[model samples]
Target chain A: MSLLEVRDLNTFFRTKHGIVKAVNGVSYTVEAGKTLGIVGESGSGKTVSAMSILQLLDTNGFIESGSIKFDGRELTTLTRREMYEIRGNDISVIFQEPMTSLNPVFTVERQVSEPFMVHQGLSKREAALRVLDMLRDVRIPNPEVVTKQYPHQLSGGMRQRVMIAMALACRPRILIADEPSTALDVTIQAQILKLMNDLQEEKGTSIMFITHDLGVVCQMADDVAVMYCGQVVEMAPARTIFGKPQFSHPYTEGLLFSIPRLDTPSDVRLEAIPGAVPHPLKLPDGCKFAPRCKYATERCKVEEPELVEVQPGQGVRCFYPDLKERRKDG
Target chain B: MGKYVLKRLVYIVIVFFVISFLMYALYNLIPTDPARAQLEPMRQQLKPEEYIRMYKQLRKEMGLDDHLVIRYARWMGIIKGLKGKFDGLLQGNFGYSQTFKKPVVQQISEPMKNTIFINIFATIAALGITLPLGVYCAVHKGKKFDTTVQTMSILGYSLPIFIISLIFMYFFVVRWGIFPLMGSKTPNATYEPGSWEAFVDKVYHIALPVIVMTFASLGGMTRYVRSSMIEALGTDYIRTARAKGLREKVVIYSHAWRNALLPIITSILAWFLGIFGGSVIIENTFSLNGMGKLYWTGLNTLDFELVLAIQMFYTVVSLIGSLLIDLSYGIVDPRVRVNK
Candidate 1:
């Protein structure tokens, strides 16, 4: 069994206008010690689907239908109390903005060591020592002094390092990183990604890395799931997805084309996927990508495509999955 | 931190000087004379020449004849208190209260003590109830408990203390005769200050006023706490806390509450300092001999000296309260620490 398996997950939120289907029939798996990158634009349900695994949605949001099995244990069926035991123990999360993700009033030691004190049943002194070691593992400078300082006392990159330390302190089996390095600058972003990669290797931890950046996915993911408008339109191994994908959904093709690279000719314009992400409440009836897809057919506008495996370890959710023919039609 | 406090202390001195000077000048503008008001009852008995002589003598003795600046300087002891004897505010002379027929310091000391006692009790009661109530409301937000607490808070906030005090007096005092209606204690009771009887009597008399005081601010304080907590709970840090596997209780109290406490502390300090002023309507309605009632009587009888002293006392209290708040910010949140 995969370390974490989410099958046909559907999550919705209660809003005044109507229920918002935030995550619609999403399925994925993170194998032991492997990274699965869930890449999408904002509001594409990447974060929500991850949150559903932990049952940590806001009060207004509810999992309408889903089965999340973490190491053969059905997470959706677990009591809230049981789920809490798994959080920060079996699985942990690192958020986007490090500056705001830590309580400003608490010391770094308190924030980082609390999981140890709670789950490991360590005394305060023991937790403090563990926190220092965890900080050291994250390559923080002067771990002793950093542990005593508050969140605001540290720089942005340093704070994110602290967050990473806190999340990985328990040596969680699975780590969910929700746009972890998106808020960081280029240099800091590279360092943090490297740190997470090293940590994952050291502990043999599985990671569900969520981001909108294809570049980040290329660097971090073993497998990639491309989400568009609350649904994963394509799934394949990272090499297959990035290197001559056999059955690429039009949305996935557009995402790949949008990447600006140093090797691209100067005169050639970078292709941006056209149109905004459809609002969750007012999503189109058929294939969600059809509205923004250059090669969308009349049939594509009328009938939604179900995700199907066209090749081994690869899935595409479009009627016209061939990239060459679709581009020629446009 | 020490340097910040010392700097704040100097600022407090400057603020007090400006406030006291304005108060004294404003008092002089009132066109009322302590001597003439005192002599009004005996005006018909004295000849015109004798009245004139008494007025001049009283003015000179009271330093009313001196220039306002000179009088202020002497009062603060920058000019006076230089000899072997000291007769200024620096020497603890708050002047005399003509209305109470005693030294200003003596007249105010007991009332100040009573006011502080009543207010501190009320504040403790208010916060003790509201802090937990606010946290509960925030945690169970959108539930029945939160809705009920929010409704009660709105009602408490809107109803004036005077109205509430009157209702309490009518029901608990006039109708039921279960609680004392007025005064800090029974007028002629001889129980020692620390004795049980004296304490009970003081509690009995201050009960209605304290309840009124607590209710008056309870709504605002609870709302402040609730909103602050709610905001904190929505922050990314709070999500991080929950993601740490901390129970809901620990998340709310240990994580969310710490950040929410800063604003709550500010409001608490404001309320604590307000104790010296006393609740005017509540004091008057209950006929308690607290600072509010004394200030009311002093103002009505044109006792500027007593009014001036009370104003100065309030100014000093406010300055000290603000300074404490500034220093406490560093303790509560290291981000604002001046030394760093």
Candidate 2:
């Protein structure tokens, strides 16, 4: 069995006007010791899907329907108390903004060792030693001094490193990094990404790397899932998804073209997506992307596409999955 | 830090001079003549010359005969422990209460004690009840507990303190006969130091007014705490704490509550200082002999000196409370520092 399996998961937020279908029928699986990257726009439900696995959704949000099984145990069915035990022990998460993620009141030592204190019943001394070791592992200079310092006292990169150390302290089987480098500078972003990759390799830990950056995904992801309008429109091996994307989904193509590369000349006019993602509440009939897709037909307007296998190790949701025709149509 | 404290102390001294000068000038501006009031009741007992002589003596003694500017300088000089009557080597005596015919400080000491005891108890009770309730409501949000607390808070806030005190007195003291309706204690009540019955009786007499004061301010505190908690919970750090798989208690109390309490702490300090001077209506309604009643009596009698003394006392207490609050900020939030 896969280490984590999300089957037809749906999450919605209850708002004053209507329910927001934030995560709609999303499904994926990750085996042990592998990385899965979820890529999408801000409201693509990538974060919600990850939060749902741990039942960490806020009071305003609810999982309408979902089955999340981790190592043969149904995660969705676990009580909050049971989930609490599994959270830092079996799975952990690192958020995008390191400055806000670490508690301002606590020292790095306390935050990093909290999981051990709560779950393993470790003594304070033992937890402290483990915190120092984890800090060393994340390449924090002067682990002792860094561990004693509060969150605000550290630089952005240092805080990010501290967060990574805290997340890895429990030796969790899975680490869910939600836009970990989004709040960091470009140079620091590369360093943090590289640090995460090294940590994953050394521990052989499965990682669910969530980001909007395709470049970061190419660097760290073993498999990639392209999400739009709360649904995974495409899933494939990272290289296949990047080199031979078979999907005719305009949104995916727009995302791929949007990334500014080093080779692109300064004067070259970058390809831009014409419009924003439609509000989930007012999602289009049949296909959510039909209004934006250049290849939309009468059939595309009336019927939604299923996530069907398009090639070996690849799946895409579209009435037409031919990129050659799409290129010509564009 | 030392420099900042010294600067604040100097500001406090300047404020003291301004307040004292205003009190003296404003009192003289009033239409009623302190000298005339003193002599009116004694007109039949003395001749016009005798009355004038008494007035002159009184004015000289009160330091009112001097030039207004000179008298203010003398007053400030006395406050700074310069030469004057009534132990000039120390700060000004605060003079005596014309209405009570007693030392102003002596007369105020008992009422000040009463006010501090009642308000301190009420403030603590209000905070203790409101904080957890607010956090619970914020965490549960739309649940039944939240709805119930919101409704009760609205109801509590709507009723004025005097009306609530009256209602409480009628129900608990009149109908049920469970507690005293007025005074800080029963007549002839004496504490035997180790006697449980005496301690209980003293507590019983003070309970109704304290409870009334507590409920009057509880709703506001609850609302403040709830709003602050909601804001803190919305911050990204709270989500991060939850993502760590920390227990719900740990996330709410350690992660969310610490940040959320900043506003609550400030409001609590304000409430503490505001009430420590006394809530006049509640004190009068309950017929408690506290500082609020003393202030009302002083005002009704036009006892300017007593009023000014009480006002000065309140100002000092509030200033100290604010200073304590500033220091506490550094303790609660690492982002701030006393020196900064």
Candidate 3:
């Protein structure tokens, strides 16, 4: 059984204008000890879907309908208290902005030790000891001194490491790292990814790594799920998706081609996907990506396409489903 | 941090000196003769020639006969008191109260105590109501409870203290007659102040003023705290705290409250410093012998010595209070400490 399975997840945000369908009919799963990279642009509902598994959406947002099963148990049916118990003990999440994530008033030790103290019922001193161990595990130098310091005293990378230490201290079964390195420089990003990869390897932890950067996903994901406008358009094994890319979700193609390459001539302009994300409250009736897709046909404008499995473990939600077929026709 | 505090302390000393000099100069501008204001009591007893002679001697004794700069120097105890010893305000001699016929320090001492007592009660009351209510209002922002509290806070904030005082006096004292009309204690009550009866009467008499002061002050404080808490609750750290699986109560009180407290803490310090200045409208409306009333009477009578002394007292207290706030800011926010 998959460690985490989300099916037909629909999340909505109630605002003054109307209800915003932030995550509509999104579905994916992560197997034990494997990483599932949920890649999307900003407001693609990637983070919202991940947050729905933990029921962590803000007060205005909630799961409209979905079955989030973890370890063969239906998470949707669990009481709030039961969900709370699972949150830090079995499932942990690291948010995007490292600079703002850690409480400024608290010492690193206090923040790092909270999960252990809360879920494990460890005393303050016992938690402090484990905090040092976790800090060391995350490879923070001078764990003792670092523990006594506040979040402001640490650099951006160090603070992210502290966040990782806090999240991983309990060896949670699943780690939801939401754009963990988006705010860091390239070198620091590499270090953080390597640390997460190493930790995942050691603990066999299933990770739902959410990011807009396809490169980071390539480095860490075992399976990749491509999302756009609140729906997953393509999902396949990371190797198949990155190498063959048999299924052509034009949005994914845009994302893949837009990445800057050093070998490309400096004068050659990178192709960027056209148009902005449709406002969540006022999305188009048909395919959300048809307006931006160059290969869109007349049928793509009037009818929304459902995700169909074209091969084993591969799904695509489009009429012109594969790039190879389009290449052959051309 | 220590250096920052020491720097603030030096600033406070400089502020105190500047404030004292300015207060002296400003009181001198009131178009009333300092010697005549003091001698108004003996105006009928002395002949015109005798009064002129006495006024010259009194001016000489009070150092008023000297140049403005020389008078200020003497007032700082660089010259002399009546006994020719160093006894100006700088030497802890607050001069005398012409209205009360006593030393300024002696006359203000009791009133000052009453002011402190009323303010302490009011401060506690204001904070006690504002902290929890503000948090609740922020947590339930845009809800009915929040709207109701905000309306009340607005009413309290906008209305002047005397208006609230009169309203309370009418309903609680005149209409119901359960509490006293005015004064800090019952007239001719035999109970000593240390006795429970006197304490109860004091509480009863001061209740209206304290409530009025608290109401007058609560609106701004609660609004400040509520907005601050709303901002703090929206901070990313608060989300982290929630993501940690902490209970809602723990998330708010533990994680959000301390961060929200920075602004409220400064305002509270100002409130504490205000104990010495007291609320002139509230004290005068209630006929209480507090610092506020003393200050009003001193100014109205043009008792330059008393007015200047009271002004110096408020300035010094407020300066020291601000210095403490700046120092405490370093302790509460690590970012400030590091930058320093």
Measured against the true structure, the TM-scores of the candidates, in listed sequence, are 0.95, 0.91, 0.94
Q: Number of the top candidate by TM-score?
A: 1
Deviation in angstroms for A154 in model 2? 1.7
lDDT of 2 at A28: 91
CA deviation > 4 Å runs, candidate 2: A244-248, A262-268, B1-28, B31-33, B37-58, B67-92, B185-202
Worst ten in a row by lDDT for model 1 chain B: B77-86
Which lDDT value does model 1 have at A161? Answer: 98
Name the runs in model 1 displaced over 4 angstroms.
B35-61, B81-85, B187-195, B273-278, B338-340
Rate residue B264 of model 2 by lDDT: 79
The window of 10 residues in a row where model 3 chain B has the poorest summed lDDT is B270-279
lDDT of 1 by residue, B242-270 (tens): 89898988998888898998888888787
Docking class of 2: medium
Candidate 3 lDDT tens digits, B1-340: 7777777778888887777777777788888776877688898999999999999988877767678766786787877655767878778888777777788989878888888788879988988988889999999999999999999999987876778888988998989987788888888888876899978888888988888788778888889899999999999888778777887788899899889988877887866765444477778888998888989999888787888887777776677678778888888887777666
Per-residue lDDT, model 2, residue B258, is 92
By DockQ, the best candidate is 1
lDDT of 2 by residue, B1-340 (tens): 5555566677777777777678778765655556666777998899989988998887676666677767665644553322434342125466567899888878988778878777778888887899888998898887898888888989888887778888998999889998887876668756674499766775787798889888888787888899999999999878777767788898899989999988878887877865664477777877777788888998898887788777777777777787777667767876675225
Give the Å error, residue A200, model 1.
Answer: 2.2
